[model samples]
Target: MTFFTFVTRGLTRRPVRTGLTIVGIAIGIAAVVGLVGISRGFETSWQTGMKSRGTDIVVSNMGRGLTPKPFSATVVERITPLPHVAETCALLVDLISVEKADMMIVSARQWGGFSWKNLKIVSGRLPNDAAERAVVLGKTAAEVLGKKVGDTLQLETEELAVVGIVDGGAVVEDGSVILSLPLLQEITGNQGKINIVDLRVTPRTTKEELTRLCAQITGLVPEARAVIAGDHIRDSQAYRMISAMSWGTSLLAVLVGVLGVMNTMLMTVFERTQEICVLLAIGWKRSRIVRMVLWESALLGFLGGVGGVLIGVVGVQLLVTTPAIRGLLEPELNPQFLVMAVAIAVVVGVVSGVYPAWRSSRLTPSHALHG
Candidate 1:
């Protein structure tokens, strides 16, 4: 029989053990796929929301927490006149309980700013004036908060009328509770203090000019940093922590898979000692025996990876549907990440087989023939 056929036969000889090994590796890979996907998805959602709002650059005092630190709203004055800056919108962003224990994002924008232009109303209309005690809910937030256009929503000590329901065109945007900056500031005791500034550049702005503008903004406002909207999340402390935790947890899971695969391969080698000895006696090279064991483990890893991807997909779907995650962001399994996961699994398989393959090669023909 051919070498490939020989490897297949060995694996099939004990289906139950092989199946269990595949399952162990599969669970490991599934954790990598699900956790990493959600973390990456969070970054993408914020970037997409910035783009949808026509924001080209962001200025903020980034902090350890997910939200930026509050800065004086007057900082916008330092940014409006530098070349290529078309408009600037100051915002006060916070996370607080809209209901009992249901903490949610509250996005309060400067009234009549360009930031308000992109909000497409699905029902009702925009608040009449900046001083009006009213708010708008993104479609997802409305569903989560269980409020309609005419409902009175409580915000700390104040109650604001919900005047409109909007579709913000991005997951992060659609999951927010939106209102006028002044109103949020008054209720949250952050009057005249805003945390984020979204900038829109003139149509004629070039890449070099944009870079210059960012540097200029940072230079003028020493307390805050300026970055292109897309790069904002990548540069944040919270994103880095999320990324590190995701990979660290995944690595632990992968190590478990490696140990499981190693144990299974070792057991298989021990059980098939006589068969390996017969091959050696018939002039099969020790290298060939080593290759046989390696091939079997690699095949197991390949199957596990495929199964893991499927499990990860289902897990992410269920996770996103929970109340805590329902409107935060949409998690998607990226093609590039999926391919990388399978590659990792294949490497894991080869590494796992090394010790077992070496042990198989150490079996002598004479010793095995008698036993």
Candidate 2:
């Protein structure tokens, strides 16, 4: 029988063992693929969330990194006139503790541009620029608070009217309450002080250039710090943590699976010892024996890899549809990631087969028959 045919028949002969091996490999592959997909998904969601704001650079108080510190409103006026700056708006972010409910409050001025990229009004009109104490509820925020358009919600120390509902198409934003900049400023008691300066720069400005510009802006005003979109320091830290944890766990799983593959191949080699010896006695070259064994190992590996890819795809799909898990990590199944996963699986198969193939090739036919 040809090498391929022999390998195929051998795998069929031990269906239960092969199936278990494939399952083990598939679990490992699925872990790797799902982690990678989630990582990429996080990146996509972060970028998408930032882009939805339509601001090129986000300037916030460089205080303790988490708390919002108010900067002078003049800072916004000053940055707006700078070269390459398209527009600038003041932002106020604060934590509002309501009766039995605490939530983040984001209030921005209507004067600054808003990117409607991902924002959709689901069930109400936009907040009026002229109305004081008016607020817009994010979809999630509305759901959680059990508040809807036309409902009155009290935030911080002030009660505000919910005029509109805004959905940012993301979990983070969907959980925030948006109000007019002026109203937000008044409620926070930082009338002339802004917590963030959102800027829209010219499209030609690179992140590096924006950083440098922001540095200069910070120099102009020490309390303010500029952060580029997609490179928010806090967000970057979060991404790194998620990526590291995901990959580390995946690598461990893969290592265990590889060990299983090694064990299976070794057992197969011992069971076929007599057959290997006969092949050598028939004048089959050692190289040919090695190739045959290696090919069989490879066939097993390929089958396992295929099974893994299938399992991983299904797992990712299930994860995306799950609300709690989906919020934690967004997984984008990019084509490139899929291709890389397959390639890695193939390489893993080849590597796992090498040692067993060598041992099979070294057996002497006479010694085997005598035993």
Candidate 3:
């Protein structure tokens, strides 16, 4: 029989054990891919959303750590007149429970600004009074909540009227509840508190001008920081931390799979002791025996890798389709990610088989035959 055929036969000798080992490896790969995929999807969605709205920069309070701090509304006025700045708006962001759903709702407001023009109201109308208890629902939020124009929704202890429904096409806005600044302040009980400020620069603004403007804005409010929204979202410490946590968990899962592979390989070595001895006595070199064992382990890993990719893809799909996660993320299967997963599996297989293969090769013909 050919070398490959021999390895295949060996694996088939215990079909149940082989299948379980492949499954163990697959679960590890799936966990890594699914978790990291969700984080990446959130990042991509946020970046694209801000870019689509022509938002040039964002200003916010520099919190103690990676979390964003809420600052006073006066910060917006301080930034409005900066050089190269054409317009500015502030937002109050909060997470509130909705009575109609089991998930937390992202509630936001445009604090003190000219009529915000980026979003289009497809039905109903925006709040006429800043302090009025009215809500403008994003398209997705309206659909998910099953609320329509003039419908009353309970938030906190207050009954608010849904004044409008809007479509921004950006997942962040489309999935959020928006209200006027004053109304949001009343509900959140943080009067004059705002979390973010969006800035739009003049068309002819140069890079130097933008930098100078940011510096001036920072000078105006030393507690706040000015950042290009795109760069900040992509390279922020918070983003890195989340990605690291995902991979950290993935590493643990990978180790578990590696152990499973090693145990399986060791078992294989024990089961084939007499066969190895026969081969050695018949003049098959020690290196050939090692190669045979390594090939078998690699073949198992290859099958495991294939199974892992399939499971990972399905897991990502389920996460993206779930109502709570669907609004904020759009999980995509990256070709590069798949290739990396497969490569990891192959490496795991090779590494796991190394000690077993060495031990198998070192066994004397007499000892292996007696065993």
> Which candidate wins on lDDT?
1
TM-score for each predicted model, relative to the true structure? 0.96, 0.76, 0.86
Candidates arranged by TM-score, highest first: 1, 3, 2
Per-residue accuracy of model 3 over 219-241 as CA lDDT, tens digit each: 78887788787765554567677
Q: Number of clashes in every candidate structure?
A: 0, 1, 0
Ranking by lDDT: 1, 3, 2
User: Across residues 1-371, which tens digit of lDDT does each residue of candidate 2 receive?
Assistant: 66688777766777888788878777877888888777777677655666777778877764543335777888877788777788776766664554334434454654434543346898887665545667777776777677888889877677788888888777556766777767777776777877777778887987678878878777777776777766653444455676888888877877766777777878888888888888789888999878776777677667777777788889888866553443333577777887777666666666777898888877888965676
What's the lDDT for residue 256 in model 1?
A: 94
**Global local distance difference test of model 1:** 0.89
The whole-model lDDT of each prediction reads: 0.89, 0.71, 0.78
Weakest lDDT window of 10 consecutive positions for candidate 3: 60-69
Steric clash pairs (candidate 2): 108-181
Better of 1 and 3 by TM-score: 1
The segments of candidate 1 whose C-alpha lies over 4 angstroms from its true place after superposition are none
User: What range of 10 consecutive residues in model 2 has the weakest lDDT sum?
Assistant: 321-330
Q: What's the lDDT for candidate 3?
A: 0.78
Task: Report clash pairs, candidate 3.
Answer: none
